[model samples]
Target: MELLNDMALFVEVVKAKGFRGASEATGVPNSTLSRRISALEKAIGLRLLHRTTRKVELTEAGQIYFERCKRIVDEARLAHEQLGEMLAQPSGVLRVSLPVDFAVIYMAPLIAEFAERYPGIGFDFDLTPRHVDLVSEPYDIAIRMGEPESSHLIARPLASLVPRLYAAPRYLERSGEPKEPADLEQHECLNILKANTWTLHKASASIQVSTSSRFTINSVGLIRRLATLGMGIMLVPEAIVMDDLAAGRLLRVLDHWHGKPTPVYALTETRLLPAKTQRFIEFLKERLG
Candidate 1:
């Protein structure tokens, strides 16, 4: 048990790249963390890390040992969490990174329900556009739209949101309604940055409609607001504009045609997840899938 504890400490030191950082992350004293790692090296009869004043680098033996120990520690932690779930409700601070617009517009109600279901759990939600570093950061998971760019992270698909063309009624009244996919070329479209084309699909046919806009947006919330304010037409998921549709702020265009389905994923650093994160992902899949 002591050996396992030491190995876990070693893994944290390597991940954090220094004793001070590992101490901050694990809430262990720097002296204690250093002592533990030294004891671990002595026990294993190998020097795992080359320590310097500025930082620590893993020795060849340390790198190999870290790879093996990380998996073992993760598995052990997972086993404990699984057992804890069988005995009681999974309880902990679940830190999650979410897309800003989706969390407010779509996931709010679902999150409320989840909170009610798991009274033992607390949450720290980070809603931002930045792609968080799941490997180095302490975030438990990140919910992202579209496919994750990094292949190193594990991505679990939660849902696919179908996008369709929509515009404020006032904008449609002035610009006139588009008759077909090609007609979109004539209208002012509100688009995300670098988005030049929108492909619309019917039962058997599809066409890529070239789009141009006066305003370029990077934020989904801002884009939705602009569409509601009658700036221009937008290709977005219905869930994003549900309130606008309900209030007659926005109306669907090209009723027969739809854009490509956008995928939502829960990104994590590893496949082995704690119960708190695992259950949260499962709940999302149940409601959103």
Candidate 2:
């Protein structure tokens, strides 16, 4: 037998007082258990038990060895229980990263619902505009916009946030409604400063148009703010403008032209996911739909 197994058996036999009792406790046969204990004594060069009677008594060495072996057995039992508990419920902190704009508008409801469902799991969220490193960073999950390039990390599509041209209702009254994508040239356009180009999709064919706007902003929230103020028409995700639309603050312009869906991704370290991550992703996907 392995040394650890022998040590464990020795401890059990000493505690139970004899091979017969230890065999019954550990389910090891009496003869094999006796031989194993003898082999352990020979290896250790110590008399562990004084036997050949109704019961057995521990030697000095047996008492010392039993103390150490009990600790090892206790540790093994604890490790087994910990693994089983991990399989049953989500535990520990689940750190996540997301864009500030997306988190505020779309993810807020999803997170509230998620927290209610998995009350045992804790969350740590970092909301920022810049991209975060998944491999080096401490976060377990990331919500990213636009198409993800090929990488080892797993990316699950939560939603395709299709953009539509929009402006404030008050702005439309001042600047007049845009009839087509080209009509945007006449209105003040709030541009998100990525590259200069914007793609406008029609019923049949899509057009890649280069735009020049007076208000060029890096922050999506700032751009939305500019549109809400009636400065210009902007192409933004419906999630961001849904409240404004419902409140009669923002109005959709050029209903015929829609921007292509900017894919939203729930990225993680691996596709073979744990229960907590899998459940959160599924929840977000369902909520988005």
Candidate 3:
């Protein structure tokens, strides 16, 4: 690597026609350029330059070396410029995995904003509940709610969303509203999967209330929709239910009590991320952090 660097410096010095000129062009000091070129010639066991008081000229060996080194330097410079272009305006298909309900209910608008911001990037999104194999799959990244199951994958925390109780006005009117955390047991609670216990916090105090419901759902979108239709009360993030709240479909049940915060993570097979993936994660952190 050092030899290649010295070769590039030599090429620069030759192009400038003198050490002083090369120093001005490359931001390297004239003394440093002179020392490096001298070291380079010594390492190659050839006198590369015939230096006079006012100017420098290439030797017969230096002439041939310049031709070869010039091409190498030009190619290396092109590669660096191309990489800089990619960093500035990344262009490619960004394939990603996302949680279905969260993507639809929460990330839809954020994705639209991102798409508008990065016009050069194309998207390939997979919104599903099944775990994606990042190591074997062609995915750039995966956005998941709650904790990541695998320790092998790299997880970057985007946000932690605290869930609150929500229910349609009709359901609340019919079954009556709970004033305390213990009162949740008497009401019909809509659960995600088989989770029957709802742990809620108030100030510094906390309580775990046993819940019962006929509907056991895997999808948050479905559970939210069910809650809106007066099926039962749901514990979910405000961002997921914002539209429903605005439309008066659901209202906060226990105003002061909040469930545990669910962590949102961006999972990757490795920490070395491409420009597209890195930008997407940064955008999410800015908006949802």
TM-score (C-alpha, index-matched) for candidate 1: 0.69
C-alpha positional error of residue 225 in candidate 2 after TM-score superposition, expressed in Å: 1.3
Candidate 3 on 134-247: residue-level lDDT in tens?
Answer: 889999999998877857999999999999999999999999999998898988898989999999999999999999998878889899999999989999989899989999
* TM-score for all models, in order of appearance: 0.69, 0.70, 0.83
CA lDDT, every model vs. true structure: 0.91, 0.84, 0.91
Clash pairs detected, candidate 3: none
Error of 3 at 22 (Å): 8.7
Local accuracy of candidate 2 as per-residue lDDT tens digits, 22-103: 9999999988988998998898899888887687788898888889888998888798899977876776678899999889
Candidate 1 per-residue lDDT, tens place, 188-220, comes to 888889799998999999999899988878877
In Å, residue 162's CA in model 2 sits off its true spot by: 0.5
Model 2 spans > 4 angstroms off: 1-82
Over 4 Å off in model 3, which ranges? 1-4, 11-46, 50-75
- Model 2 pairs in collision: none
